[model samples]
Target: MTTSLKLKDLSKKEMLLAPGHRMCQGCGAAIVVKMVLLAIDKPVVACSPTGCLEVTTCISDYTAWKIPWIHSAFENAAATMAGVETMYRALKKRGKISQDISFVVFAGDGGTYDIGLQSLSGAMERGHDMLYICYDNGAYMNTGTQRSGATPFGASTTTSPAGSSVPGKMQHRKDITRIMAAHNIPYVAQASPSHHLDLMRKIQKAMSISGPKFINILSPCHRGWRSKSDDAIALSRLAVNTCYWPLFEMDNGKTQLTHTPKEKLPLKDFLRPQGRFAHLFRPENEWIIEQSQTQIDADWNAMIGAGAGASGVIEE
Candidate 1:
């Protein structure tokens, strides 16, 4: 059963991720971190790989996290968190630790979709009791806006710049959520910061469930995406409304759609706000938008089919 939380239920929650950090304004990653931290009531040990969330939150001689936090390198957050969880199990078995703790890893697309996949896959395969989240901003935003495995097709980035000679990023973004689901983990979900209740409910659900859990969140980057800082949340909503970033979850290999748009918006509505896809509006590049729209529709339809075939309905 999916538990529902009212605004009053969360009013008294502790602020685990403190403010006054240097994360950019309207940063989706920042919003996701804070919300994820606040979603739980149990003690949590948080881990973050080297990226915007890390460098901006933890600086020399200070920190923004109120809970016990560890800063890992770009490729080791999953491994680090797994080790910690294992140690906790051992200690509890020995009667040295009595308190329950949730182990969580917060890594970016570069850390997760690219460098950290090995450790991540291993952790899930091992069936560790933890929740791993990837705040995907679609690029290696911390490293000069370079193209990453999560970068969108035809989007301009530092390494995949659009020009007359070539189109931006010759490939589509990798489907990490589907890849995680393939691991046969207990829980796998795709969420956005714009939908707070949905995201929170998923987190609460993960907290109750045992075994490995994963949440892939669409974290918009203003600098990398070349969008207005204040537009991050709205852009996130548009991404969901267009079905570009579908909200779904897979439980025990069953698929469920969390939020479906009543009238799915056009792909352009989601892409037009971000400068990364600006060149696609050119006469010569209009075909790219059409191609993207076609692909989005196909993917959405396939997801719906999967949801119907194997239901992940809350067992309330």
Candidate 2:
């Protein structure tokens, strides 16, 4: 599979997401979200949970969103989107609102994988025709870089600070794709900013599918991760190459990897770039790297097993 994706071919129109936003330099979430909105031209109603995206896009008296948007609490984006979907369907039945509108809920990893998991699960279990997108920055970036379920092993966060004995986050990152797939939804996929074209393609696929679709986007954060502003795309690419974040999709029923690295890079190549794992580079912090690699190996093995009967990894 080609790592060099044609992200701009999906839509040739001018950028819908304008400039002068409050997002920090090299913020991967901003670019990915922009491409997400650009993937579909139909009317859209978005339910956003409280997080960095919400805070930056919906500041007091300042709105950068071009589509119909609703600001909900941190843990209720799924529920809010459910209500909006219900209302839209009801209105369409009554000939009060058009049926062409698409409903999407955007939340952070903390909101989707932890606090909002119940509501999200409920919405998916109930089979709502909506898309739930989780921008996995790997921690609670808005309040603080606290250790969330999405935080990778050995990465340091506010809640998982390194100490004399404790290296960093002790737990492995949650397997969100598998968790969503277990819901038996129509679609579930993982994407990253490095593969913008593929990301947009999956967004369109999710929108067209009935029932529910869940997307876990690996959006790197410069502020929280202590990475360089210009290394966003490089970091994103390294994450996939290192198997720290795999790119794949679970279609109507079949699961397949979207991209398999030509050569798997070491976990250190992925972790050492960010200051979050800087402590892990110390002489005595070798255990952190070893544990991290073990976790990645386990995940890739499980993915291979689950997709054994399916076709080879999907090509662009």
Candidate 3:
């Protein structure tokens, strides 16, 4: 039998996002943004770079945002947000904008892992008091599903289309969470819409912390992944279970695994459902599936070591 729960139980008692936004149906990014907003108890100052979320929320003059928001350039979201927060700090000292505001920056994989990597690294290194969220939909969905650095292996995007000679994206996703952790930021975590409570908890904790915090959210794009809108959350769950995306957190300078699936699913179970990787099952394309499974196994082992703190890493 199926059970039902109220939205209130699944989310916080706050409403920052209202109706009339243009996000695609079952867009994971929207749910992520809502969770972030709900976790913030103070006035919020959010900056979004050019991406799907930005375009959907801010059309000509119509804005779906209730918080103080800004739309910055496509590649400088972190730099711009850090500057805004620095100015806010300066302004507060001069009795300008109040000091009760929380700062947050929303970036897509194209903006964070590809174009904005340097800027993002700089902000985290400088220890800015802000939350930078990378809504990784695996490709540049807003720009027509082009491959970005964060695109997973074998996913067929516009730029990396499946064809006679070429398969899809050539590279595995960048290890963004580890890159953030390397900066020695106070907090860094991976989250997804499949685990609402865990996502909300991490956001609240990150907000309470006092340095730069990064949250990498697995945002499933229907158009990019070529999947039905309803499959977004299920795909997210499959990703975690298959070890394609492991949920974990780094606090101060230690790593800890947040969630481990009870029943590990096969890589094919995850790959077969998405049209982006449909070519992998085509007799000749089976090697891609084998490669994916091998990578998942290696990654799972790495995560186990990272979690056990056997490599001199402490548990966060």
Alpha-carbon RMSD to native, per candidate: 2.6, 3.1, 4.7
Model 1: runs farther than 4 Å from truth? Answer: 1-4, 309-316
TM-scores vs. true structure, each candidate: 0.95, 0.93, 0.92
Lowest summed lDDT window (length 10), candidate 2? 1-10
- For residues 1-316, what per-residue lDDT tens digits would candidate 2 score against the true structure? 2112255554465465667668888788898888788786567788888888899987788887877889998788998999989888898899997658888888899899888899899999999989999999999998879989999888889888998868898888788888999999989999988877678878888877878899999999988999898998899989988989888888866888888887889989988889999999999989879877887898788888886333444453
* TM match of model 3 to true structure: 0.92
Candidate 3: Cα lDDT at 76:
88
Candidates sorted on TM-score, descending: 1, 2, 3
lDDT of 3 at 271: 82
Per-residue lDDT of candidate 3, residues 223-293 (tens digit): 88988989888999888888788787888877777777777889988888799998888888788788878
Clashing pairs for model 1 are: 1-315, 1-316
User: Stretches of candidate 2 above 4 Å error?
Assistant: 1-11, 308-316
